[model samples]
Target: MREIIAETNRLQLCVPTMDDLDGLSALWSDAETMRYIGSGVPWTREQVQERIERAIGFCADKGMTFWTVVEESTDTIIGQGGLVPISFNGDEIELGYRLGKDHWGKGYATEIARASAAYGFDALNLDRLVAVCYEQNLPSRAVLKKVGFRKLGQSDVYYGVHALLHECLPYDLVR
Candidate 1:
């Protein structure tokens, strides 16, 4: 069963399932789409499978994970976004999102970021949320700023690569 966690005007964020493998594989396999992601390399189908499984486990154990983003009108899995434990630092939750290249520049990133922050602060009762993006990922940085994340400068703390770190509190949210 697909559990819908959050919704926007055109998208629904849902807990990932095995059924999302194909769509996720396609999204994560695109080099352009994976450019700003970890190691800046596309993921294999098997990697996608493992990630889906991890997402399921995270949902069951922590009540949150990177959720599958579905297009409301077409009912298509267009991306993934939500809250997840900071891999390198378990004490903090991170808000993140990724979208198919076709969905870029459509304001979906901001919507996803806003939804994720809301879920973290409201549903998960999180006091603080953090986000990091590649230094070159200006668009992602912009989205974070638009959603009320204060940039805390560059840090190599989360992912192995150096990234721009940002943090947000419930009261810091713009909307």
Candidate 2:
């Protein structure tokens, strides 16, 4: 509801737009990316539109949603990193991110995650920030660890190799 926009050292974050459908569809269509997420069939264009609408609604309701992560120099939307809902985990909010294959290993995830976590804590005043990661997602786990989240332990998540639950608190901002 509050129109969240965050700027990090290398990227700018904003709400997902209808124009992002192509990128969202492309990103969600990847087998490697969705391997851990339980998308039975790749999302179509219409589905992407629906996703955008849903994201907007989420922002309207919760005051936040999956934000676009764009390069500061070129303004290219490399990927997205955001805080989204986890209904089963006590309706908890969790950090989520994905970049193109090219953007991997650049510390983009860490950079964006740190900002998102800070926004959640300081602006949103969330009690705890958490991320659910795939067991085999070493890169994602590494990013979460680097950004002040700790492995709270494992959870029986339906999607992924295995789900490792990570969390951080405002009082303990760094790991």
Candidate 3:
């Protein structure tokens, strides 16, 4: 069963199930969409399955994970977004979002980031949330800024890549 954890005007963030493998695979396998993610390479179907399994584990153990993002109008899984322990097991939590090529530039990223931040702060009682994006990922950085994250400059502490780090507190959210 799919659990709806959060919602926006046009999207629903749900706990991912095995059924999401195909949708997630399609999203993660797109070379352009996979750019700036992890190794900056598209993930194979097996890798996508591993991600879904990890997400399920994270949700069960930590009460949060990068949720399966669904377009409410079509009920189609377009991407993933939500809070997760940095690197999947770090002490700090981070808000993250990703969308397929077809969904870019539609303000959906902002919606996901804002809703995820709200969920982290309000629902999860998180004192602060951090986010990281590739230096060249201008649109993602913009989304983080629009959501009220303060840039902490570059850091290689997470994801083994030098990412532009940003942090936000409950009161700093734009919601």
Candidate 4:
């Protein structure tokens, strides 16, 4: 059974499982949700399956991965967010979150983000966490900045879009 890693008044972050495939597919397959994420193209069902498999494997191997964020009141999966181990630029972890269109502007991202960062720093003992987004993705950039991320500079043009990297130490946000 997957453990519940974090919970807020309205959301719960838990490990992704096969049971989440449908919710995740609906969330990931929407073009609007896919915008600014790697490629702007929406993910196919097959790709969503593969992603679920990969997320499960990543959790087993790394003890960390993007988790399913569910709305507690409705028992509906509104999104996914968490800390992911990465090797980009160096050995480090990155924070990421994506929510369904219906859930946008609800502050769920920031709520789950705070819990994820606390888990990464206080529980996992990570030194820092990083986040990257397309330069034009103002909403995401704003969320990262609001969470205390400082712009490190531009990153490689990925998926035909210029990206920016931001980083924050656990203390930067937690304290």
lDDT of 2 by residue, 1-175 (tens): 2233898889888888877777677777766766655443556678768878988888778877878778888867778788888766686888888776667788888888988888888889898978887778888888887787888788766244357888888876652
Pick by lDDT: 2 or 3, better one = 3
The root-mean-square deviation over C-alpha atoms between each candidate and the true structure, in angstroms, is: 1.0, 2.8, 1.3, 1.8
TM-score of 1: 0.97
| Full candidate order by lDDT, most accurate first | 3, 1, 4, 2
lDDT of 4 by residue, 50-106 (tens): 987988898898888999898989989888899887754567788999999999998
For each candidate in turn, the TM-score is 0.97, 0.87, 0.97, 0.93
Report the lDDT tens digits of candidate 3 across residue range 52-154: 9999999999999999999999989999999999755467898999999999999999999999999988888999999999999999999999999999999
Cα-based RMSD of candidate 3: 1.3
> Comparing 2 and 4 by TM-score, which wins?
4
Candidate 1 Cα lDDT to native: 0.92
Please state the error at residue 3 of candidate 1 in Å: 1.4
lDDT of each: 0.92, 0.77, 0.93, 0.85
User: Which of candidates 2 and 3 is the stronger one according to TM-score?
Assistant: 3
Question: Residues 89-152, candidate 1, lDDT per residue (tens digit)?
Answer: 8789999999999889999989999998998898889999999999899999999999999999
Best by TM-score: 1
